[model samples]
Target: MKKYLLLLLIGSSFLTACAQDQFQRTSKGTMYKNFTNNTGDRIKVGDIVTINAIQKTDKDSILYSSYKGAPIKVQVQAEGDMMDVLPLLTLKDSAMIKVPTDSLFKDPHAQRPAFFPKGSSLIILLHVEKIQSLQEAMAEREADAAKKQADEVTLVDKYVADHKLTVITTASGLKYKVVQAGIKPKPIAGDSVYVNYVGHTLEGKIFDTSYEQVAKSAGLQQIGREYEPLKFVLGQQGIIPGWQEGILLLNEGSKATLIIPSKLAYGDKAAGPDIPPYSTLVFDIELVKVVRSKAAAPAAATKKPAAKRTTKKKTTTKKTTVATKKQQ
Candidate 1:
């Protein structure tokens, strides 16, 4: 029985060697046709290559290809097998590599299949584009950061100039702003502010609002319905910092113009499609009402109600404290 098992193993090994020989090139004075990856140059282990190749069957039908920008950078790990065609690429040399799907990913605790497709197989055709060095990658990232800062500054300047936005501090205190006398009112920290705001881009494109939010929550999607007042707790991070800070300046019925810097708006990331990357915002905000919550004042005091009568004369002092420090 052991002799029979040894013979079976030897036969299987011979068949595996024969199957591998199909992928090799033979040279009898170049008479045999050699299947070279005629697309790009050979790839190496450490080179980061971009591929726009597709998988297909033995009859050559394509499955997928990169349709967007330049090719992607494939980072090679320090250990394990790094695909089959790593030995066939050079720097800036583009080539196609066919990788088996079973060899792509491996997980032990998975359900259903063992390998990628059980008895089936798949292929990944790759093209070696360019190799990225650590220094080169860092430098490129730093350059992008610098460009973003310059853009944000430029956008802020343009917004301020075009909108004629003013930033005058007010005697009413409480994050003050002056817009058409008595039109804007000061709000306390704990007030629930209902604001009708239209946020616009540099080209006067409104991207978001409270009306849109209510309509969206109600399953309505029309643009006209998206223009409504949104109610939120003041000083909370529910909206951007610009919105929070700007709204705190308005009295219960104030209409104010707020020109926000990109840092205060979306920070580093781009907002909605209308708000481009590194964009400054202009908001025309109208304060609807200051929601007076019964529990808003007692959040920090924690004193007895009968003792509160002794501090009745200090109501304005308590309101001032709520305006400044806040409970947080």
Candidate 2:
């Protein structure tokens, strides 16, 4: 009985090896193996194909998978690349394609990406979800976008109503209300401003705050992170568009609640794990201080070419703080 079991295991391993060796190569040298043989129409050039894709390295480490999000929609082309294999697939078909890294980075002058080392093959597992005309795909996408925009507006409205808040809506769709009005002399572009703010989603879930106590209360405290007033130049592109626009309405010592739409916030892209795509952000902000800009001074008779100023945008939503110093 033991001898028979060993023979069965060996036979299964051999069959698996033979199956893996059945991959066929395309004219461009892309190797692919189809798991399904559907009799439906094959994908063609100019056809918009929706597919669920899983990208991995030859070591079987997953790089990305559409299962976690929406499937991708792409129009097929005559390009001799890995996408060339799409033409051989039909709707509802499943397949695997392997592309060499050397072919992907064929430019000898360019340095290859560190993740994709030389002689490594990028593997792709694909499932064709749908095939449609370009017109149909565009119409569908537009409808989806319209629905999402309406949904976001409904969510923001409900949150405001539930909190019993009155907001002043702006022409650009920003809704804000001055809780404590400040004196005149509001900050303008090119001015340095300091602020303490608490940012949350429409659901009232706090994602970030400049106050250390707030972070502790929300269980968001990070070790070695100093929670203090955030300092940045007003009109700098480092912050979101909503924050930039809403801050302009407040003067030093003013406190306001800004309810920003997703379009003015992160839009369709998710910011980290806490802020999801199409999220409507609510910020309680206090304008601590504002320093006037030197550029706003009256131009001198011999104006040296105004030096171009460039600021690097912060990639993350978390605010950075500077060490507190005695104000001169």
Candidate 3:
């Protein structure tokens, strides 16, 4: 029985080796096929290469493609065993790699796309286009970022001038234009206020809002989360600093536009995947209602008793009139 078990194990190992020999494989079990053998300069560590990559699933559902725009520049580094193929590619070389989804993402807790099913596979077709030094890539990216920042500043200034807005600039560099006046009682610290707001980028792309229609139009509606005004305490750290400062200036029922610069907004850190770093934001806000302090709230609650008493008196008169008619 021991001899037969040893023979069975040897036969299985032989068949596995034969199957692996059919494709170029990484030590971690990822398989690849080289489509072209261009004798161009091979990739090396510390080299930044521009490559056109298309990622798809076994069902041919394309997840990402670089054909629409410029190829992505990637630095060849040892991120994982599957990434070891990056140094084996030459300029103008093309290859397709098949990777097990579970093996690629070994961490069970890692977040994945909703479309990517477990125990499935991914196919990546990559073509190396060009190569550059690490220093060159960094310098180019920095230059592009600086140019983008300058252009954004110019655009914001032009919009302010074209609209002819009479905006009030705060000491902290926040610009606000009040469209409509509100009641005399303005909100103060520790007061709870309900606000309706639409937040957008400088380019007029709406990111978020408290309006159902706006969210629906933007294709950002969440299931079962009905849209309504947001309520928070004023002058607390419950919200962003720009919101705290801007909302305090408006009274109840006021409508205003707050133009917040990067420093007063998210600054150099990104708020989410959609909001880039150093982005300027705009908010159209309406102060809905303000809840008074605890001491004043009791007084407001006391007035409700008088209102209830008046309603009771009216009901009693109607009942008496009906009884008198019945007797007649």
Candidate 4:
């Protein structure tokens, strides 16, 4: 009877050790599943699909997922970007796949632990909810884009209507021109425009101006403090929207005085001590010449996309900021 009791104790010990060993190994398996692939589309190597998936890592972490009530659209072509299930695309929708650790995305951008210097493995559990074709995908994208544009236009129109500020043209149909009777010199929509201008606060403190453009043009100086009339592809966010909108209404050699309200101009932001917050700005603008495109402007020329309303700012501000090194 003592020997029998000893045998029972040993058996219990062995069983407990095996249970612990099973618990330590982090493998992929599903806790729950409720998805179906009804579309029977023959998935090719380049097919993109909307999948609702969840991923877990060896650190006993559930790292990534697309199972947030909405199906995530994923391109199979971008499979190499992230891994875990790329090497094996065996299971389709409604199937819970246990992914091994060797198939995770190898990233050059991840931090040290995420990208182990010694390298690590990841396990994944996936659920694909739906699939779509390339054309169908493109149509969905276009529909979303159209909806966004419509929404933006509606909001902008409502704001303009409430503020009574939708009149964007002068009597001569020029938006940016010298403020004078019957002399609406303005820039046109499709014309390449050049301009000299000055910016100042409503209190009339000068901040920036193209006044030195004349001295530089006259060859009396190697460089000037002000920028010359520059060229850009109009309507391309190459310049401030105010300048673009204003310039689009002016013809060649037209001039204008643009009085920009705080909101339309740089609102609630200190451009410098020169421009205070909530300042209604003003500019004496001129449209120097309207031509075809000046040239393909470099990335530096139109680097920053504009962030303000353009009553028309002629964007011909192309004065080279970099100076050539002169021999000492």
Candidate 5:
């Protein structure tokens, strides 16, 4: 009786291993295995599907994981791609997909990723989280954006009140407070202005500055960088809207604080590792000089080429906090 039971246990273990190795091939020749076959509604074309996914090589080395951050939301496509397999998965379903490296690098001219070598397969482990219709997805996105914008406004307002700042609110929602008044000549559109500025997040973490001491204090000092006032033409498309509008209210030698909302800055996109998406920025700005455009400049200055903007050296600094798109 003991021998018969031992043989039966061995047989069951063998069958289980064989079943685990079996994978189904799709019409497009992709190999897949479903671990949990749920009866819930399966994904469909145009459906926004949220899933937690882990991408790895055949060797089981993980390349990327949505679990570390946020689950991925993808709009299902008709056919012709790995995403086509999404239609087979229902909510809460878990599956494994194997894609041949050769198929991924089909173009002979294309270079294959070093991790996924020739003859290897890229594996994807997926867990379906949620599924929504196209209309539902759009509505949810809008609702989320509105909530985020409202929350940002609340934070900004609180920051202003906590700091006991008396600010002038602009029509576009920017807030500024003059610390010290300067001369009578304020800058206008098309004027080349040189300004020294220090920028930080709402939490008071400095991200960028034109002053060497400020950068050193914030631990953001870049080697071989020449810390100097940033120069840019007012009303230019390259600079952030907040700086363009706020700087117009200040004159040479004037010092002020500008509290910029994300919409006036980077908006939904993160500036760099330091500045997250939807961040509210604060800047201490000092207008050093202003040179009017030729149209606005005195006649004698018009003969000279509009003072060409030049850089002292090639700085390795990443332009995360500068007003200009490429760092003013």
Candidate 6:
């Protein structure tokens, strides 16, 4: 009985080693070893898969690790060489794929990374976390964008409350409080206004200013052009929606502070290297002057009426007629 049991244990160990050594290769020269069974639901095309992956060169130098941050979300397709392995994965599946570097940089227009040398292998360790339909993924993205906007709004509301600011909130989400109510002649929608302003983030970092002294002080001056008030047409889209709406609320020479939301400013997209996405902006604007657009003159003021056609009554020619008859 002891001899029979020993032989059976040896056979089981051999089978286990064979199972662990099993690996598959795709036609494109991708070698993948699946550590998990594929008995669960499989990933399909058009499905959005969320994965945490760590990529490395053949030398084992780490290129990227999504485990350090958010998992990468991708739509499965059989086209891209890198994405070919995605269709073979299921939720909670883990695998390691060795892809030829040349295959990825095959396109002449593609730029290869400098760190990855030619003829080396690209190692990928992927873990598929979740799977969802394309429609579901799109819906989730929209919900996330909306939630971010809501959070921004809440933040602005908190700032307003904390400061005990008395501001006028417009229908379009612009908040303003007039500082110096300048002379009459409030700007209207069609006016061209020149404003000296300083724009900053909520943290009070000045990004832009129209005044020379302020620009010099902030070290943001532009060479060759003298600093002066920025002139723009009111209600025009030439500037941001917030500036257009807020400038019209003040009169000539008026000074006010505008608290603008991201929707009215850059809106989820970063403006530049300085401004991040979904940032609320603040501006201390002084309305230098509000001049009406040249074309804004009243139509009737330049119109000319048609000249009246006058008719003179025929004069009596009796004296002349009699003189001609007498001479005849």
lDDT by residue (11-34, candidate 4, tens digit) is: 334334433544222123321221
Worst 10 residues of 6 by lDDT: 319-328
Report the C-alpha displacement of residue 13, candidate 6, in angstroms.
24
TM per candidate comes to: 0.56, 0.73, 0.61, 0.37, 0.82, 0.69
Ranking by TM-score: 5, 2, 6, 3, 1, 4
- Clash list (residue pairs), candidate 5: none
Predicted model with the maximum TM-score: 5
In candidate 2, stretches whose alpha carbon ends up further than 4 angstroms from where it belongs are: 1-21, 55-64, 99-123, 295-328
Clash totals, every prediction: 13, 0, 0, 28, 0, 0
Kindly list the per-residue Cα lDDT of model 1 for residues 1-328, writing each as its tens digit. 4533443344334334534654432221111111234554454556555544334432233354453334555655444333444454455433222334445445545453333454444433444456665567568767987898797667656756675655653332112244643444477777787788766666776765556664465454575454657888876766777777777766678777777766677766767666766677777777877786556354565533331122334446453212233332
**Candidate 1 deviant stretches above 4 angstroms:** 1-66, 69-90, 97-125, 128-130, 163-185, 211-227, 293-328
Could you give candidate 2's per-residue lDDT for residues 80-149 as a string of tens digits?
5547899999999877777888888899998887778999878777789999989999999889888988
Q: Output the TM-score of candidate 5.
A: 0.82
Where does the lowest 10-residue lDDT sum fall in candidate 5? 319-328
Query: Which parts of model 6 are misplaced by more than 4 Å?
Result: 1-23, 27-29, 37-39, 67-69, 107-114, 184-193, 201-238, 270-278, 289-292, 296-328
By lDDT, rank the candidates, best first.
Answer: 2, 5, 6, 3, 1, 4
Cα lDDT computed for each candidate against the true fold: 0.54, 0.83, 0.76, 0.51, 0.83, 0.79
User: Could you tell me which 10 consecutive residues in candidate 2 have the lowest summed lDDT?
Assistant: 3-12
Error of 1 at 326 (Å): 34
Cα displacement (angstroms), candidate 4, residue 162, comes to 2.6
